[model samples]
Every structure is written in structure tokens, then in C-alpha cells.
Target: MRPTAAAFRPLTHRITTGAAITHVHNSSVPQARGILTLKDHVYFAKATARGRGRSGAVKSNGDCPLELKMATPKIIGGTGDGHNPEQLFGMGYASCFLGSLQLMASRMDKKHVAEDAKVHPNVFLGHPDDPTLEGFGLRVEITVEGCEDDDVITAAHEYCAYSRMLKHGANVRVTKA
Candidate 1:
């Protein structure tokens, strides 16, 4: 026997306010709150890192454990075993920016723009000359390939989440190659 719509209705009532509800057929609930909520959707990602800076390791809690060996260069007085944080950030940003390009392309009805697009995110860590300021800062250069028209590329960059997030914080530049 299959469950009826009424059977599932009660289960949704227990959901807390502001929490994402996976399924809600009754439109009145959202209207009453005067708020828009993501329906039938939830996204989550988790990871844990250990050890010293640059020379540490990280693991994700997904079905497949993603173990990463992190290390620094000999110039920094450390063994360059695997990869550094900047490289990892660049890799992740590149992939995410590519997805952002696809998203913008679809929204703008220019899906062809992203068909063969490639994103190269270059992450650089540098120290400030000012002695008062401690630690280092990052500079990013994102190179896009397989697409022309600088205006369209700029539009896509404006729509990219990574670009938006880092724009105010880092020296981020997007260019065509």
C-alpha cells in the first residue's frame, strides 16, 4: 500500500522555522511566513584538517574519504611532500568558477559560451612590506579559455560566487587567454 498525501503532511509540520524543508506541498506555509525557502533541496560538505601549517593533512567525511598530503617548499624550510593550501584553493576555485560560468551561461541563454570554457585560478601568497602588518595576503588571477567577448566574460565573472566572495577580500583579476 502506498502512503497518502495526508500521511506526509504531519511530518513537515515538525520542521523548525528558518530550517530548510525538503518537501512542502502546501503553498500556504511559505505565504504565511512571508519568506522564500529552498524546497526539496539541501547541500552539505564537511572536512577535517590536522598537523602544522602547509605540512598538514586533511580528510573529508564523504562516502569516500579524501585524504590530502599538504606540504611546503624547501625555501620555506619544509619538505614539499604533496600540495600547499594555495594550490588547493586555486584548484577548488577553478572548478567552482567553471561551474559558475556554466550557470551564468544557462541563465543568459548563452550555453555555448561555457561549452568549452576552461578556468585557471592562480593563487599567490605574498607578505606585506609594512612591518606592522603580520602574515601574508593572497592574489588571484583567473584565466578563462575557449570563450571570446570580454563583456560576456565580465558578466559571467559578476555572476560567479567565488569571484564575488573574493572580490572584496582579495586581489582577484579575471582575464581571457
Candidate 2:
């Protein structure tokens, strides 16, 4: 049985890393609520260093805010209409795969000979009738220059976590083709 609101004390948990930084979250309150109270300097710094949103994500106060979409970049096509969520999904998946590969390489202490690695990730959306989001496929082709066969293979195997997150048995079929 779940605890009643009257019984809830709004427990707080703090995560501190060796006098460097501290993060606190209340499980009962919404994540957005009291978020401003946190001294999120380190979090902001990390995001900024990674070239992520610096100002911070703005919240929508409206009941139904206007749906704004970014024009798709010229490289992917679609008249630079960023409105297509599919294009965004494709880009996200491709970038995620490459990131995972790089992370794996770093963990293995394998140095990349080339500065940049190429990863082509293809994302296919299922028919609208398939509300389960089934049959959504992703194909990633990686071409890393100056990397030996052993390191490349190890990276590939280590990066399988991305595919593992897909809905179980929803056909996240991967092929080297």
C-alpha cells in the first residue's frame, strides 16, 4: 500500500562528491519544483563544457504551448524544415551511437588514431497503426579511420547497450549490412 499524503514527510537525499559539489532532491516534490534552489554550478559547467544548453531549458507555463520545430539542416534534407521529429530522432540515435563508441574506447584505454569517427545511423519509424512503436529499426555503420581491427571490434561489442534499451522483442534487429 502506498503512503498517504498526510504520512509523507518529503524525504530529502543529498549527493555530495568529496567537498566538490552537492546535489539534493526531494522524492515527493516534482523535479521542476525547488530546482532553482540547488547550487547547480558544476552541472551548468559540465553542460556548458559539452556545448549543451547554457542558459538552461525554459519551461512552458501555458496549458498548450505552440509546438516549435527546428528547420532540418540542409545535410539531411526536407527543405531545412526542422519540424520533422523523425530527422531529430535519426540524428540523436546516430550521435548517441558514436558517443557510446567513444566512451567504450576510453574505458578500454584504446586511443583513437583519427581525431573523428564516422557513424551513420539510420532510424526507421513504424507505421502509425503500430502504436506499440514496434518494428522501429536502427542501423549504424561505423567507419573509424586509423583504428586497428581488435579495437574496432571491441568498441562495437561494448556499444551494444544502446540496442539493448529498445523495447524487448520489438524487433531491434541489427545487421552489419
Candidate 3:
């Protein structure tokens, strides 16, 4: 069974209580019960899918870059003409990680070193080793170009939200609509 949000806390978080106000966007707001998070975001987006499974299409609710036509790979009995979820995940991870790496390098006084950093992410889908879970599982390997310093990389990993989520796990829930 999936653990409830109230019961599951990240290993890195220390729970806080009470109406402690935080300044965000020049406004004071009460801290959430479990932990303070980005309830208010600088950017927001929504996507919806249409049509059959992997053969479907996905588009953003508002202005978006592309209206994707998804297709399963030939190895899985698909036409393989279009994109897949793995590709999307890799793109998001790479972009986010690259931004983090660049920021890290700048903070470390090595701005020139990672000015052209590129994050390459390899996302692999395979059967889960855990028996209770479903068949599909994902693993990722990220390589950063233009900077190879372990300290910079380590700092970036810590600062990056995507990196933290991959390493520490996340709370997700699905409900029937």
C-alpha cells in the first residue's frame, strides 16, 4: 500500500508546525503543516493527453512549444515514428540539471568553466526488481560537459530539484476521477 503524505517524510526534511509566516512574493503566508514548499510558483504549466495510449497526443493547456504525437517504440510493437515518455523525461532532466550545473559553477567562482555546460541524461526503462511494483521502472545517468570537477558536480546535484527527487524519491498519488 502507498503511504499517506502525513506518514511519509523525506529523509532530508525536518517537520515544522504552527503558523510561522514566510515571505514570498513580498507577502506573508503561513507555513504548511508537513513542510514548506513552493505552493506558489514562479512558473506554471499544465498538459493533457488525448487519443489511444502511446499512440495518443499531448498538448499544454496554455501556450506551449509543441503538440506532441506520442508513439511506442518498434521493440514494444509500436510504429516508433513519434516520441515516447522516456525521451520527454530525459529532456526535462537534462535541461534542469544543466541549469543547476551552470548556477553551481558561477557560485563556486568557476563561471567560465561551466558557461557552456551540457547535461546529457540517459533514461532507461526496464522491469522493476521489486515484486510488488509494476513491470516498468526507470533509471537515469547524467553526464555534464564543460565541467568535470567533483566538487562542482556534487554541489549542483545538491542544489538541483530534479537531482534531489531522483536520489531521495517522491510522494505520488493517483486517484480515479
Candidate 4:
């Protein structure tokens, strides 16, 4: 019988705005506002083979296909402007820091293998020789391939909630937006 705090604050703001309204922004007006609007009707098909009409097909709403492309994506922040939101918050903090370093390498059994985790973060929008972001920095390059050396020096002294809120700092409590 414990349900105060505005009844769980609308389920934690619907799981953080439902993971940011089901993120789908690869451009083109936010990808046609999350697909299905070229006047609908399956978005044109049935006219191929020497007919010149089938060079576009990454649009769906039922089987998960609203434009998403990321082959080995690890660009967290901007290196040359490929996208923003700090590269989606550095790819969600480099996949939650490699799933918490593979759950601490399976409860200390070792053989760690988070083969690929990157966060080339940078948001110094007004520094780095007059960038502009004002302040933001990240340079976490974790590629611990086949693990060893005491599980990569014991997950490099673990404890990484986004690197402890970027080390020793966190008190976000805004009210009345």
C-alpha cells in the first residue's frame, strides 16, 4: 500500500516521455512525422521491374520501420555535425556503459567483452576555439574486445551512471516548466 507522489508521477512521466516519443528523426520533416503520410496507401508500390518505381522502402509502423540507420554507430556528440542531442546523449551513455560492463562481467566470472562502446562526445559550443555549446565534454573510448588483464582492470574501477553524472555533480530538480 504505497502509492503516493502523484501516483508514481504518471508512471515516471510515461517512462521518460515514452523514450522520447519513440524517437524518429532522420530529417525530412522528422521523417514525414514518423512515417505513413505520403498520402498513405502503403506509400506507392506494385510497379517495378523496368518501371522505375521502387527505390524507397523503409517505411512502416507495425513491424518497426520508420527510418533508422546506424551501422556500428558510436558517435556520441558532434565531431563534424552528423546529428545532435549530443549524439543522442552519446548513444544513451554508450549503451548504458556497455550494459554496466556486461553486468560486471557476469558477476565477476570475468572474460569481459563489451567489444564496442564509444562516446566521442563534445559540446564546447563556445570554446575549442569558439565552438558555441558553452560547455560539454566526453571522450570515452571503450573497446575492450576480448577481455583480460583482470577484466580490463576491474572494469576500470566501475561505478558509471553516465560516468557519475560526468563526475561529482548532479542536482536537477526543476519545477514549473
Candidate 5:
């Protein structure tokens, strides 16, 4: 049987590492329910960044020494020493969207939709000269491969968290390839 929220006790489990700690709250309250299994539910990733705007570096709180250097392309007069924010965003979104796609496919009994699937998220940064407009904007094109039908891909896209988050706020297009 599936474990409901009422079956669990209301407690917060704190996992700490070095200077970072993440609190996982297990609630029995019926109203505060989450769409996840009992054991594996909440997930978190923490990272800190320092330096100038496009020339900064970020490191995760994990034991492994994971660091990233931020830089813009030389076309924009940047040194292009490392990846920029747009690339990182694309990577994160694509990976997350692929997970969502796989989950949705499994749930819908369409396992082949996600088998050996690949997601390509193309993120573009644009700056308008209009003073009234914001500093910059992003346009994303998410292309999915190994999916048989566009309808299935669209359904998965609709269920993706990144797609939901950027649906109304950003200009995003999803295509099946």
C-alpha cells in the first residue's frame, strides 16, 4: 500500500556537511502533502558563487571538488574562458526535463518514449536597447530526440517542472526531433 501523509510523523531530519545543512521535513498534516514516495522525495543542491558578473566561479557543497568558471563568449567581447549562465541554465533545464520526460513516460506506460532519449535545450540571451525594457531576456528551444510522436513529447514537456516554470515568464519552444 502507498504511504499517505498521515502515516508519517511530523519531524525534520537535518543532514549536515561541513558548513552546509539541509533540513528534510516529514509532515503528517493532510494539507501539506508532496507528490513523492516515502523514502525518496525532496532533493536539494547548494552552490556558492563569487567574483564579477560574467567572470565568477561557483562551487558546490558536496565532498567532491566541483567548481565552474563563468564567462561570456568572445563575440560579446568576453574572454570566453568558461561557460556562461545561459549554458548552465540550458544544461540544468535539459537534464531536469529529461528526468521529467522519463518519469512521465514510465507513469504512462510509454517506456519507449524515454528509452535512450536525448534533450537539447538551446538557450539564447538577448539584450534590447530600449531603456524601458529589462537588461536582458532569454529564448529557449527544447528539442527532444528518440521520441516517436510529437504529441507524446508535448505531453512530457507539459509535465516538466522547468517548462511549467518558464511557460508564462519566458519565450520557450519545444520541438520533437
Candidate 6:
């Protein structure tokens, strides 16, 4: 069964109170939550990367028409001439969240407000300040313009796949081919 905004209930109340928000905002690996698998994927996007570290290049597969040269951001000690992974992630999340917000809004009969809503997403890179954790980490912040309804925002947070993955870690398997 698809989860509704009520599935994330109490979150709506929490948003209003500004206390005890459940979503994790840190770079630490997420704790396991519920699991649901779809019988079929709606779509699959593939991309390839070559070169070294942040100085590489990424190109989308035949399915997508995208190509970008990766560059380490100045904040992380490199020339910020090209795009970085964070920008891509931020853009993806913003797009997904905006859709989620609009979806929930339409369900709540507030589609008019969401029709012009804008999502501001920020992906920050840092140490994540965990002694046990190594390497770089990411922090995300999203702001939705034109919608202040706690229910819509909370529902969108719950609905967004990116947010869900960050909150409840996805099953990731790395195997050499």
C-alpha cells in the first residue's frame, strides 16, 4: 500500500511545534526503516564516470542526454571550474521534493499553491564530525517557497525518495563486475 501523508502523522504536529523532527539531517549512515520493493521499476537512469576522483567526467547513458566534468568545489580544496556531484544531487532532490510537495498539495485540495511552488535545496559537504566515520559527508537543507502548510511539507518530506533514502538507508550492494 502506498503511504499517505497520515503515515507520517505526528510529524505534521512536530513541524508546527518545531520540536522532535524525526528526519535525520546528518551525514551519518541512516538507520534501517521499513522495506518495500516494487515489482517493476518506473524508470532507470544510467551514467558512467571516468578519470580520477573529482577531476573526472560523467556522462549519461543513451537514456539521458547529459554530460558533465566533475571538479572538486573550492570549499573542498580544488578548482570549482566544473560541476560536482553535490550539485547534481541537490538538483535531483529539489526536483523530486517539488513533485512530492505538489502531489501532496493536490491531494489536500491545495494544488493552486503548489502550482507555483519552488524548492530551494542545499547540499553541504563537510567532515560530518563523527570520529568513527571517515571521508567526506553531506548535509541537506530544503526550503519550499509558496507553501507553509505543515501537513504538505511533512508529507512531501515523507514522500520524497531522496529524503526517504537519507532517513531510512537504502540497501546498497557494491560488487565488482
Q: Rank the candidates by lDDT, best first.
A: 6, 3, 5, 1, 2, 4
TM-scores, one per candidate: 0.66, 0.37, 0.73, 0.22, 0.66, 0.79
lDDT of 6 by residue, 3-105 (tens): 1111122233232111224443321333335654557887878888888888789999775589998998887788888899989998998899899999999
Clashes of 4: 4
- Candidate 4 lDDT over residue span 1-177, tens digit each: 100010111122211111121222311121111211123344422211221122222222444334332221234332332233334455656566556666676666653444443323232212222265454333333333334443432343244455444432344445672
**Can you write out model 5's per-residue Cα lDDT over 68-175, one digit (the tens) per residue?**
988878878899999888888889888987888788888788888678988887777776444677667665666777766544565566666666555423333556
Per-candidate local distance difference test: 0.59, 0.37, 0.63, 0.34, 0.61, 0.69
Per-prediction tally of clashes: 0, 6, 0, 4, 0, 0
- In angstroms, give how far residue 45 of model 1 lies from its true place: 2.1
Q: Which numbered prediction scores highest in lDDT against the true structure?
A: 6
Output the better candidate (4/5) by lDDT: 5
Better of 1 and 6 by lDDT: 6
lDDT of 1 by residue, 134-168 (tens): 87766666677776645456566655555555432
Candidate 2 has its poorest 10 consecutive residues by lDDT at: 1-10
TM value for model 2: 0.37
Report the lDDT of model 1 for residue 20. 27
Question: What is the C-alpha local distance difference test score of candidate 2?
Answer: 0.37
